[model samples]
Target chain A: MTAEALTTILIAMLGGAIRVSTPFIFVALGETLTEKSGRINLGLEGNLVLGAMVAYAISFHTGSPWLGVLAAGFSGVFLGLMHGSICSLKKVNDIAVGIAMMSFGIGVAFFFGKPYIQPSAPRLESLPLGGWASNPALQQALEINPLFIVGILIAIVMWWALANTRVGLVVRMTGDSEPAARAMGINPIKVRILATAAGGFLAGIGGAFLSLSYPGSWNEGLSSGQGLMAVALVIFARWNPLRCILAALLFGAAGALGPALQSVGISQGYYFFNAAPYILTLFIMVAATGSNSARAAPGELSIAK
Target chain B: MAQAETSFATPPAYDTARIRASIEAVAIPLGALVASAIIFSVFLTLLGKSPLQFFELVWRGGFGSSFSLQNTLQRATPLILTGLAFAIPARIGLVMIGAEGALVIGGFAAAALAIPLVSAEAPVYLTMLLMVLIAMAAGGAWNAIAGWLKHSRGVNETISTLLLTYIAIAIMNFFVEGALRDPASQNKPSTMPIGKDYMVGNIPGTDVHWGLVFGLVLAVALQVLMSRTTFGFAARVTGGNPRAALAQGLPVGTLIVVCSAIAGACAGLAGYFEVAAIHGQANASLVAGYGFTGILVAFLARHNPLMIVPVAIMFGAIEASGGLIQRRMDMPDATALVLQGIIFVVLLASDSLYGRFAIFQPKISTERT
Candidate 1:
């Protein structure tokens, strides 16, 4: 409540927001792209867990964090390919397949990740953005990872590409109408598969950010459903790449609220604060659903169905 | 292509078509099971473990003896209940995965309620009955939130149910680790135990608790409710086409909400039994993934209440063998999880096979081939 306490809470929350939101940024962007291609991959949660574990184990064994990140992305691609291929089959439900992929991805991750839980892995470094600040706490809070910048840049690029590029047109066409796309000589299935795989690649990188940067460890509990939350974020963002960054930052702040409050010597309702993002997402969803039909969604997207 | 044209050229008899439909229902899921088993065996072999030995151990550890069968049955109890939870909503075209959350909240509610009553020396029968009712009510209400949202606002039920699960767990954690934490439960924060005097006893001749009986009775009752009643008819119509159901003047929203509540209640009862029969207290242990596993059970059963019992028991047997598999094969307990994941994926993918099978294609013409 005091000026100093408020400063402390603000600084801690800012730091936590930067730390926690990086994963959200990548996953939301990934989901945004996938949804734009008329598919929703709920297995991104599994992708996150497996990516975190794979990133950590690869980093631990190779002593190269970047390599681990790359491996994590590839692991996500593999899972994404599995999801895309299975879902492409006739009569299969996309949502149910997503659920299966989630379980499969998580199960495989846990099975291989058991041994890497205790060992420390090489981690990604951050640039001190607050180097000119006099306060050490402020300086620490300003340290930003390279991925944060990369996420922002990618968002801008995606926003531009989605609106301008020939590839973007094909993707949009396919998402809007499968028959139309087929008439235009674009195979909707292929486009969706590739888009899903690309989305998965981003989600994997997001997982790497968790283990290699902030939490910076390989563990089963490393992700708290950040992957799943990305769907909500994409919806909140109206499937815009640029808006995903804002949504991710907001979620990061919400996630950081509990820890930030605890840092300021206020520990009451910590669990409630911990659950803020889910509640917020649910509220936003309810609010969003009330205003729109499938108007904001891709015509061929199966989420509502 | 020519063979298919020839088969289709002549209309088939009604009896043959009926036989084909029946066979396909059994054959598809059965084939999926066999396919997943083969894939799992390949996975084990790649890991340098003998697939043959692993399965033999599973059989011996799960159902080889009376004790093992009872253990499997005990574990199956929760799956059966949770499967119904998923199955009921699925019948109404809703993907409700909040059963896990419902179970946790339901169980936690039961434990939290027991504190003052036990201290007040409430009669054992009254206390137990109250706990069961409280658990079911808690769970039912919890899941109903998602159902209501889907109908009222068009919120995606799958995502909503998933979010509710996390919220449910957080709510339970808030209580168990805070106001209701028993000082005696160090290292693992937990609620005050209901005590052995209030614990539900097992069947007279078996080690399995009364939850099994509850699951059996509920499964049969729900099967009838879903297949043989007007409510069931309305639900099936809604599931097939919500727009059609609405056009028919069916209460679509009510059916959706009712199915979700029943699903939640079933899951909640599983939670109550976990408290009253197994753990004796509510803690992090109550957060076990029984609710998630029940999804696989329901899927394997094709969301049929009657079929859920058998599928759940098989899954339970697989899980009951986890410890044995871990020890004998030097594999992690997640081996079972991996197998389940594979089965689930394969089963869902096998949906494409349903209409593809020539035998399963019903001939409405009813003419002799």
Candidate 2:
């Protein structure tokens, strides 16, 4: 490929990375919180899809993208609550319940989402942060969504709280050792459940972005396992909220390889590029697994350590 | 307060009264099923639909007649394989959710491999063996990734497996839509048909293909592998306590990967049959939710391979009935999913029953009184 084309590909890739990373950022933050509290919600894929549908439907009805995002987050909370409550029941496996909830969530979303497929919904606005650039290509690549900033801020706050706050200590204690947590009179179950619900809420918001922002539309195909991939991303980030943000951006760049290449008239190996995120996840997991840092994962969390 | 005392008094006698405990397990799940139906009815009521009419429609559509039973069996055939896919690995304590991925990749690989054999005058049995092997290999490798990750990295198998599913599906879509698209079908991209003569034949009396038999055979084989073999014992030991298994010198990682590969192979075989027997080509037809439904089936069967057969057929009935409900009640076809989800959650919660049944606990305190 020509140097100009290579440059174009690089710019498009950066742009695509920003767009795709928004949802990952939201979901990774949520999963980090949930994992920190010693519970895992694998059903966020369901939450993402349902949130996408709700965001689209609500935006269509209210003509407000913000409202749609809020409604989507609430819908995610509902799913999270269901998963948390069911898992909290004695003898119920959290992972299994999460899997079941995923199917239930997606099924419900598809069923209810059928009507909104054709209708136009209000979409989120992007800020043209690259207006200062003289090059048109640079300007085109600068359309950043506001939610990206919000996700970053949430990650920073979560990181501070997890390291410093009393609630964070309790959550960490619960994840580190249930016996210690119980001895300290903390209800591990409740903490885990709340964390899961909060995580779901964020995932739901992430889903809403898909429908109400870039590639903006309501459809059954809007999500392709971003929620599920977030779980892997959590382990890659070592369950730290701040690290999750960086991981999300890296995943986004990997995911954008296909479309970004396509923009530069390179269509060969698009499938391989599309498979990049998963491949990256597998390799990162391999690198991190059984290692000192990964071993540092809280003992109670199932993904690592 | 009395951990040692409580632990020392657990032995109990078995009697006819224990049947009540079994009944309660079934009863609670049944109640949950009914409750989901009621809840679904309420949703329908809000949608301005009659709940009574929907049930009648489902009854008539799913099992009220022989034709429906046949349809149910046909649908259940795939579920049986996919359910076994989930159930088999579950026996060894791995939650392998990549069956869906295995199914798609298996179907694609099966169809792709069939391309070369079609023009040659090969023996029919040889051709079938080649197809099954190709399909199983595709699926086995797809699932082995998750297993390898879990055993190697301590990465949770569930999410990695699930992510692999999306990658698998995307690969299938790209291949079918781009490289393998049949020239004649413009709108919907698909592979070339495998032709009628090469297609799998149905059972003599039923419309269901020989895949149903394969599913049953697999279930039985897995039952044996899980119950009567040294491998089964090792796997169980690993599953029950990985640390203990390691202490005992069991090859825990190999067991996990091998079990996952077997599970994926089952799902891949299901995909192969779906292509060769039903769709006759790989397309959007292969993307249906059979793999996800199998997870429910596996869970409902309590992860028992032997139990998967009947439970699969039951779910098959529900799926067959979904169309009837949709046609008669104007409801969406996802009603079966709602019911399945409810049953799954309730059944899982019922796992607490092992110690709770009064019959299972000794009555020494009562005897003293």
Candidate 3:
């Protein structure tokens, strides 16, 4: 291949990475928060789809993307509440309940979202980071969504708070040991529920981003299990909120490989490339799980050692 | 010899208290179903449809007529098998979400095997045997990946199995839509059909295939395997307390993998039936939510293989009636999914009732009595 073509492909790949990574960033952050609290919510995928549906419908009705985001977050909180409450009940397994909630949330989303599939919604716009560039490709590649930056900022804040703040310490203690948390006079259940709700909010926003931004459309097939993949991403990130952002971007890049390759007349093994993100996650999970220095996972987290 | 013979004899009578406890256990799921129906009724009202009419339609379309009953049974067959897939592994304390992957790969394997045998002079029974074996092997291997990860590397089975599912679906898509695509099926895009001669036969006096019988048989067999075997005892022990089982010198890792493989094999068999009896070939048509629905059935049945049979059929009837409800009531097809989801959550939450209910808790105030 010519250098010019190769460079174009590389640039397009970067652009695709950023575009796809936005949702991953939000979702991984959400999952990281939930995991840090020693409870894993696998139903984030449902939150994502429902959030997208709610966001799109609200945006279409109100002509405001921000409100749509809020609505999406609310829907996520609603799901998180259900998940947290059911899991808090004696004998109810959190992971299983998360799976159930996933199905339930998706059902509700599809049921309510039937009408919003065709309508256009006011979408969140990308910041013109490359406005001064003369090349169209360069400008397009540089146009980063604002949510990407917000996600990074949230990750940074979360990292700092987790290390220093009392609330963060409570969460850490609760996750490390329920007895320790109880000794400290903190309710582990409450902490987990709060963390789960916060995580759901972020995931819901991520879903909104998918519908109201890059993909810029609403459909049932819009989400291809990105929410579910985020759970693995959180673990791969070692439950670090900061690492979650980078991991999400990496996953986004992996997911975009097939489409980017397709755009440049390279269609061989597109399906395999499409499967890259899931394969990468499995590889990371195996590696992280076997590694001695994979970081000390939360004690109460079922996925954690 | 007299004492031994006396000990082997049947107990005097069925215990009324034990029977009542069993009935109470069932009440949780029943209550959840009723609650979900109420919640769904409100939803239907919001959508401008009558919940009564919806329920009536479900009854009418699912089991009112002989034709509908057959359709429900046909739908329930794979569900029963898949439910066993989930329920069996769940009994061993492994949440194997890779059944969808197993189903897809199994179906693909069935189709792949059939392609060669269709034109060959292979005997019909041999072809069927080859299909079942290949399908189960593919599925078993698929699930074994997650089991190995869990037992050897401490990776969580849930995430690993789920990720593998995506990879499995992608692999099948590549084969069916590209390499194995029949030139004639252009618009829908499917693998080559497995031909009428190689197809499974219908049960006597019914349009439904023999898979329903296969499902029922497997359920009963698994029930016996789980309740009456030493291996099942070890599996139960492992599930209840893995560390304790390890302390007892049980090969916990091997049991985990083997049990998971068996679970995957069950789902794979379901996939084989789908391809051989229903879809006629492996394609996107096999990607229906049978695997997911099976999870609910497993939960509703509390992961008992025998209970999975009835639970799966109930769900199957609900699913079969979904389209009819949509036509007659102007409700979305998602209505059925909503009900199923609600029932699943409620049933899971009902787990709390196990030790908390006084009916299940034996009375200790014998002195006062």
Candidate 4:
């Protein structure tokens, strides 16, 4: 390939990385928080689709995209409540609940969001970050969505709070040892419920990005399992909020490879390229799931075993 | 020993412990189903629709007539197979949800294989047999990858299976749109048809295809395999207590892999039937949600192979009625999904109530009392 061709692919990938990674960022971070609290929510995929639908429908009806984002988050919270409550019961497996919640969330979304499919919703606009570049293609590629920045900021804040705040300490303690958390007069169930809800709020925003920003529409096929992929991304990130951003970007780049190659007329193996992230995730999982990664995981995580 | 067992078992008048256990097993899931129906009724009522009509239509569309009953059974064929796909791995204590991917890959493999055999003018029976074998082999291999990873590398089976599912679908799409696309299949890219001679037909005097028969035989075989054989015992031991199984020198890894492969093969057969009996070709049309719904079926059956049949048929009935519900209730097709979701959640939640019910508990044996 020529240098120009290489540059084109890189730029396309970079653009794709940013566009695709925003959802990954929110979802990975949400999963990180939930996992740190010693629970894994695979149903975040459900939250994502529902969130996208709610975001689009709310934006269409209320005329404010941010309110749609808020509505999406609350919608996520509702599912999280269902998951947390069902899982908290004795003998109720959280993993199975995650699966059930995923189906329920998607079902609810599809049921309610059917009518909003055709109508256009007000969308969140990207910040003009690429104006400094002279070429229009480069300029268009550089237009960063505002949620990208907010996601980064949230990651940093989460990192700080996880270390410095009492709530964070409680979460960590509860995750590491339920008995110790109980002895300290903390209700681990309540902590888990709240963490799941808050984590869901983030995942909802991630869903908002899919429908309100890039690919900007409400549809059933809006998500091709991005929510489920985020759960994998969290494991790859080793449950750290800051690392989640980097992991998500890598995934985004992988996701972007197909469209990037397609844009540059290198469509020979587009489908194969689309499979890259999943293959990469499996390999990363194989490599990461040794003694060190296990130590990095919260001691009480049900998914760990 | 068989004769002795039959003779003694026939006259057991007070097997309360055995009787209660069986009753509890059946009663819990039934109660969950009823509860979900009630909740779904409330949902319908809130939307100003009559829940009674919705169910009435379900009965009418799914099982009211012989034709509808056949349709329900026809749909249940795949569900039965996919439910076993979920159930087998679940018996080995792995929650493998990659059956959908296996189905796609299996069907794709069968179609891809058919192209070569058809071009060579292979005999019809031979072509069908090879296609079935190839489909089962492909699916079993696909699911085995996840099982292998889980046992050998300590990667979580659930996540691994889920990832593999995406990869499987991608691979199929890659082939169908490229190497395997039949030029004749315009508007929808698909593999070359297996031709009418190779098409799977329904059972004699019934509209239900031979796939339902396949499902029944497999369910019975698996039920016996799980409850009667040494291999099944090892797998159950591994599921019940991995540490103990390892201590007893049972090959836990092999059991996991074997169970997963068997599960995959079941899903693969479903895919083959889907291609040969229903679609007559492979394409994006093969990407139905049967694999995911099978998870609910297996769970509702408590992962019992025998129980999967009734549960799968029930789900199939609900599924077959989707169009009817949509027309009668003026609801989206997702109404079925809503009911399913509610049923699944309630079923899992009802897990906690199993031991709590005093009546279902085994009667304490007391000579003095």
TM-score of 4: 0.97
Docking class of 2: medium
lDDT of 3 by residue, B1-369 (tens): 445534644431234356656777688778888888888788778878888998888888889999999999999998998898888888888988888889988999999889879978589899999999999999988888889889998888988889988999899888876778888987877788989888999999998999999899989999999989988899999999998999999989998998889888888998999999998988888889788888888888878888888888788789889889878877677888788888878888888877676655435212212
Q: Compared with the true structure, what per-residue lDDT tens digits does model 3 show for residues A1-305?
A: 87777777777878888899888888888888888889889899999999999999999999999899899999999998889888999988888898899999899999888988877888998998989988798899889988888888999999999999998899888888999999989989999889999999999999999889978788878998889888888877888888887888788778778877777788777788879988888887888765642556888877765
The true-versus-predicted C-alpha distance at residue A7 of model 4, in Å, is 0.8
Model 1 agreement with the true structure over B311-344: per-residue lDDT tens digits: 9899889989999998888898778878989999
DockQ of each: 0.76, 0.53, 0.84, 0.88
lDDT of 1 at B128: 96
- Give the C-alpha miss distance for residue B35 in model 2, angstroms: 4.1
- What lDDT would each prediction earn against the true structure? 0.90, 0.83, 0.86, 0.91
Candidate topping DockQ? 4
Full candidate order by TM-score, most accurate first: 4, 1, 3, 2
lDDT of 3 at A252: 78
> Could you tell me which 10 consecutive residues in candidate 2 chain B have the lowest summed lDDT?
B360-369
Worst 10 residues of 3 chain A by lDDT: A287-296
Checking candidate 2 for backbone clashes, the offending pairs are: none
Two-chain complex of model 4, DockQ on C-alpha atoms against the true structure: 0.88
For model 3, the stretches where C-alpha displacement exceeds 4 angstroms are: A290-294, B1-21, B46-48, B365-369
lDDT of 4 at B93: 90
> lDDT tens digits, residues A1-305, model 2?
79998888888878888899999999888888888888888888888999999999999999999999999999999998888888888777788888788878888888888789898987999999999988788787788998888899999999999889999899899988999999999998899888889999999999999998877898877887788887888877888888888888888888788888888777877877788788777777677766765765777876554
**Clash pairs of candidate 4?**
none
- Model 1: CA > 4 A from native: A290-294, B1-16, B364-369
TM-score of 2: 0.92
